[model samples]
Target: MNRYYWILGAFAALVVLLAVGLNLNPREVPSPLVGKPAPAFRLAVLGQADKTIGPEDMKGKVWLLNVWASWCVSCRQEHPVLVDFSRRGNGTPIVGLNYKELRGDGAIDMRRVPAEQEVPMALERAAGWLKEHGDPYLLTAMDIDGRVGIDYGVYGVPETYVIDKAGIIRMKHTGPVSPQVLNEKILPLVAELNK
Candidate 1:
């Protein structure tokens, strides 16, 4: 029947669309922020509430703005690579934006706590994690409540942006930064931007 043929055609179309989508890499999602000025933000340094840092501080120097959180499993996976890179003294300063810190290990939700206690609690957790692993950031800015992350169009944690000396966002990587991504994409770009 004609009706049966129409339904089959619709299902086939849906299948083709899904196949195309599945073949695409989620990490390569294009960002509208690319080629635009990095969003401006002045956030308190993690564990150092008295101090603050922002994109303006890094002007005239190529830098990496890495969005991470204590709760992100992927961030843990990506941390060592960053630590190694920093140890190499590549001259590219990496500024960490600690996005929405929450205890992700099936523990109490940090949101239920009093507002005044939130930052300290998050800082405690993040400090412990960094100590256990390694702190790669030149300075880590605490983006409590993730407001800065929202301004940067963060869909999730563990995102990274390469900002040139002009403060324009050159590249946005949406997922964990593997060693290959660092060596192949980020490092090369940073080298070019620094020149």
Candidate 2:
């Protein structure tokens, strides 16, 4: 019957849509912030209470804003790549945005700590982690309350942003920065942006 043919066609269309969706990479989720000005925030530098830094401080330079946390397992995976990049001293400074360091650590949950002591406790943990894992940041800023992360439209930890000399966000990598991603996508963009 004609009605049977219409139902079959609709089901086939739905199947095709689902198949197309499945082929898309989840990590390739497009960020709305790309091509926009990098959000501003002045937060205390990790392990340095007296110093605070923000995107404004890095104007006129192509820089990377890496969103990470001591608690992020994926952060650890991408850290070695960043460490090697920093060691190369390629002229692009990586400013770490230490996001939401309040949790992680079965022995002692930082979330249960007093509000006044939370930042300090988180800093201590982060500093220790960096010392052990190797720090790649020119200077890491503490986003204790995660307000800065929220402003930047962070979906989760381990996101990275490539900001141009003019402070516009040129590219946003939603997940860990592997060597392939660095060499193929990030480095090429940085080279072009610097020119």
Candidate 3:
């Protein structure tokens, strides 16, 4: 019947659409927040809870807001690049948003690793990791509950945002910052925004 044929056609179309979506890279996913004002949040600094930081504090400066987690493997991959970039002191400041650091059962990864060896997911743990791995952030804010991350449309860890001096989000890079991404996308944008 024609009705049966129509149902088959619709099913085939859905299958094709799903296949295309699966092939798409998540990193290339366009952000709705691009060209919009960065989300605002004031949170306690990782190591210093008494001191808070937010978008308002960096209103007049071009900055990189790097959302990282101590547990994210991709963050480790990008750590050296961020560290080197921070040391270069290219005029753009780097701030860190430490998101979802605490876990009720203390499980940090999907591997289901034992809790005894699992890294503690707390602000102190993040501060320690930064100290041992080399702290690159001019200021680091703690988002233990990940509410701020939701506001910024974060899909996962290791997302980086380039905010212009006026506090507008110019670009967002999802995933580890490879040298090529830093050189080709971030650095050039930083130079342009600074000017």
Candidate 4:
């Protein structure tokens, strides 16, 4: 029947569309960098005089590299976990990348554009939020020009990386790095590195 064939064709097209949409979603791929040496470069911590932070600085210690921007609300959610990781991970250092910008102007820092519209929380509001919530970065690098993020392939915030003493990327976590990632991945790796 012609009507039956038309329905079948429509169903097939819908299936194809769903497949393509899901495949293109960034969340499907867990991480972009794992089991690779982290790239080396220096970036300045805004409002700090003489204390530039970078991959080279982390070479001597096992550390958590957290890529976040002022505008990322989810980053706020994971900030406390990062503070805990900094304390528990063999006193491992925490590196922060405030991604995207010509330079962090104290008001605005660089961040990526999300595929879907995130509830737009401006950088200023996010900064105030952090001050109220607390900052987790032991050494925060103001990633002006977004080059550092591009090097690290940080598509968006709340991404955390575990880096070993020799600068190898032990793990990469996409999305809000919860307490689970800290317990399962970060702490274990730091314990291993310390031993």
Candidate 5:
């Protein structure tokens, strides 16, 4: 019994050490998107019948992509910031990935798709959302099939990423971008891109 107790104690200590070591030695999983080019997507405005939009649409310009949904209140919270950010328009335009909406059809009539458990988020609502709050993004598209979201490693709505002029992702933010984050992180990053 004494020998068994000693063995159990030693095993417990080893487990604790391994846990602490693992936590300290964090590893960054190679994002399939890191070194290579970003995944291409072609989509259109919610109700506009004007033109088709795709990654190639903005080629040669530094941009930002936000993964958001109408059903996500946090996304709603971040919406206005996007508007404000666009108002700055430092040549870095913001775009939206409206996850939870179809496949194939580039033109997403927000009025038509099931809005994440049937919650509606029309372009008018998005426009109103910007009007009441302000407008930032130049392009906003419906990721009806969630394929774009998965490609960008999005586990939730309201996440934002800064894609460089070369189309490589330069930054990732998982929550609402606060004013502090904007001033401290976003501005500096954008400034560098501009130079």
Candidate 6:
């Protein structure tokens, strides 16, 4: 009887824990990297192979680092919001990290297929996509090998990080940035951090 009671108590505790976790927003999943210094990387510029950019270049400025890929459907959903934000000219630079993508069709996800011959093509495709869709980035960097993505702890494309002027990562949103999230969470935080 004592053993049975212990098992039941353990089961109830697991149920409570699961319930709490389920109630939390998936996008708001706490990252250990938050409040830490932003990961550093210097990658080739998307359009210009000779140029490179990274967090080091953006020091002393409050900025946004948006991780996106041409293959990510969610990135397309969030693009208009970012475009609008850029057009507003709020003085907050939006740096783009063009994550893993494949060649031939932009629909081919890099994670699903091994990318080797496709990288150069992917960069060309990305450049064309931005040209057609209207680029919102102050400068877009290419993470063709995805080492930079790993450094940033990117679980998926379309993640965004808001870095303060001091270069500390203040907020990380993992998913499409809808208008509601931009207005309710990101904008206010940026305003406060800038001050």
What CA root-mean-square deviation does each model show from the true structure? 4.0, 2.8, 6.3, 8.1, 6.4, 4.7
Kindly list the per-residue Cα lDDT of model 1 for residues 12-58, writing each as its tens digit: 99999999999998767699999999999998898776899989999
Ordering by lDDT = 2, 1, 3, 6, 4, 5
lDDT of 6: 0.86
Candidate 5 structure quality by residue, lDDT tens digits, 139-184 = 6776766777887887656777777788877777777787788889
Model 6 misplacement above 4 A: 1-22, 26-28, 103-117
Q: Is candidate 3 or candidate 6 better by TM-score?
A: 6
Q: Indicate whether candidate 1 or candidate 5 has the larger TM-score.
A: 1
Top candidate when judged by TM-score against the true structure: 2
**TM-score, ranked from best to worst:** 2, 1, 6, 3, 4, 5
Q: Is candidate 1 or candidate 3 better by TM-score?
A: 1
* Model 3 segments more than 4 A misplaced: 1-24, 104-121
lDDT of 3 by residue, 116-166 (tens): 533334766788889889999998898877889999998778999999989
Q: TM-scores across all candidates?
A: 0.86, 0.87, 0.80, 0.69, 0.68, 0.81
Candidate 6: residue 97 Cα off by (Å): 0.4
Model 5 steric clash pairs: 83-135, 83-136, 86-136, 101-144, 102-144
Model 4, 20-102: lDDT tens per residue?
98879577366556778898778766446566776877668888888777657687788888766555545677777776532
User: What overall lDDT goes with each candidate model?
Assistant: 0.89, 0.90, 0.86, 0.70, 0.69, 0.86
What is the C-alpha lDDT profile of model 6 across 63-103, one tens digit per residue? Answer: 99999887788899999999999999998899999886653
Query: Cα lDDT for residue 160, model 5?
Result: 78
TM-score of 3: 0.80
Model 4 regions more than 4 Å off: 1-32, 87-89, 101-130
